[model samples]
Target: MFARIFADRFVLLLLATILLASFIPVRGHAAEVASLISSAAIFLLFFLNGVRLPRHEVVSGVRNWQLQGAIFLFVFGVMSAAGLAMSHILDNILPPILALGLLFTGILPSTVQSAAAYCALARGNVAASVVAAALVNLVGVVLSPLLFALLAHVGEATVSGQAVGRIAIILLLPFALGQMAQRWCKPWVDAHKDLATWMDRISIAIAVYVAFSGAVVAGIWSIVRGDELAWLALAV
Candidate 1:
């Protein structure tokens, strides 16, 4: 039973590692090492994603512009409407910065992994779901800032060309590179699928750790109240 549980939930273990890392107090030089480790882990995740992305699959889906457009429009419309409505309701209650964070969260597109998992569980089209989610995120990399600027009057602070470029560099470039590598690595990826599997598990763990550790080091965790954390957790 224990073995099966671990087999099914390896990602959670990585998350635990990250959380533990975040709590480990470090002095001057040690803190720098910790920060470096966290940054390395985050980059490793993106690198792994790039290495694992299936080029043929992504290329084939590129022709399905109609489906991609539908997904992009749906995500943009729903998130935009939801953000506006939530902002109106919570404008007086939540602090502006927190509120902006919440809005930013909603502005983000649906995560590809979760959306694909849900589609599989529902016996829906997993391929379509994966492609759709990917397209939404890709488009959101640009459209999000534009919508924020237009609807929220979010100036240079909330949405900027630089932000779009940075996001594209960090996220989209990895995905594109992964796709390009997929063809060359197809046979090996098939023969040793465990490599991709491990990369996925490790990447998620690193991400959670880096996020929590960064927050802890910056003292942002202390400023936020327990109730606010609870709310954000629930909101997500």
Candidate 2:
């Protein structure tokens, strides 16, 4: 029981972090510093992720193009279209930022590590799921933002050139650098996989906390009422 709960610590951490942000959201100069720290945490998280993945596996994952292509079409294509349609449907009902979030979530990549595990649980093709997830995510790092730009409305939200640059510089560039260093770093990474996993969890929690801190201060509660949030959850 304890092991299971410990294994689910990331989820618990996220819930706790959200509550903390709701009660005591970072403000003013502290908010700015938190943002910078989150950025750096994100940079390190992606860098570690880059270092961790085996390049050979990634290349192999790429060679399985049919599965990758299908997933790509679904994740970056069909889902984006669905999100765009739904965002429009809820235009009068939901807040603009919340509606935009619908599109953003649609464009976001699949959780690579979880895909294979889920597939295994369902007694599906775990190998195919693993490779397809990896390849799709690798491409998605670039494709998601571009797709969002294409699908979203004029003012609801915008993925500016700067946002793209940040994604590239802060997210993709580090991952690429990690891949380049993978040959030398792989052994160390393998030995300390548990440490890396903890780092990943902590970094993600920090990012979420910082983001919600801003949202909390920006009147996220005032803008999104309780009923609307319930409806949004159901719609999703």
Candidate 3:
């Protein structure tokens, strides 16, 4: 019963933890270490994800490009537009910092595990969900920063080509390695699939905590409001 309750409220727990962490301060070096650990954890989760997926399903869905592409575009476009609209509106009624909070919320890509789990619950295609969610993150790494530069009037310094290239390396190389590793150890990962699931969930929780902690370090909590969070939830 406890497990079932946690499963149902994982996203809520993540959001709550992120909010709480945003208000707590950490030392500078500890912050950097936490960020590094969080990034590694998320990458490992993604890689293990690559391993645990049925290879045949991923390969077979290569032919279903339309479904994947549609979902990807829809999620990206909708989220971006909603972010811009909300931020602009909030900027008028709220303070600058709170408006900025809305911007960051929109900048993040669609989450993979949540999307996949929700799709399965809704009796939709899990493979399609995985592909679409991954594609969102993969493309968002470039498109998101570019959008900020173009639409939000952010400085080129923040969206530098060098930075983007580094981010691409950080995000892609791990998945590539995981794919290769999974192919080599397919039988073993298949034999112990349950461990991969636990790792994925734990990594997500860690990522949430780390993100909120960074926001706290940056002093975002002081600006955000209950009303804005409610609107963001509805928009999402």
Q: Best TM-score goes to which candidate?
A: 3
Note the residue pairs that clash in candidate 1. Answer: 50-178
Residue lDDT tens for model 2, 88-194: 88878888877888888877876643554345435566446655765666667667766776776343333456655666676667768988988888789879877
* Residue 104, candidate 1: alpha-carbon lDDT: 72
For each candidate, the alpha-carbon lDDT, in order, equals: 0.62, 0.73, 0.66
Residue 156 alpha-carbon offset, candidate 3, angstroms: 5.7
lDDT of candidate 1 over 1-236, digit per residue (tens): 76766665664576577668667735457667765664454444344445554555556666678877777766788777787777666666666777676677667786554554445435565445656776676667678877777667767534356755754665456556655776676566668756655554554555455556666777867787888767656654
Can you give the TM-score per candidate against the true fold? Answer: 0.68, 0.71, 0.72
Task: Between candidates 1 and 2, name the one with more favorable TM-score.
Answer: 2
Model 3 misplacement above 4 A: 1-9, 12-16, 19-25, 100-104, 111-127, 153-158, 161-171, 224-236
Clashes of each: 1, 0, 0
- Model 3: per-residue Cα lDDT over 1-236, one tens digit each: 76776676556667677766765645489878877886777677666656656666766665688877776666667766777788887676666766766676776776665665456445566555667776676677677777766667767724456755654555446656666787576688778866766665666777677766776776564556777666656544
Candidate 1 residue runs with Cα over 4 Å from true position = 1-11, 14-18, 25-56, 110-138, 156-184
> Candidate 3's error at 183, in angstroms?
5.5
Worst 10 residues of 1 by lDDT: 41-50
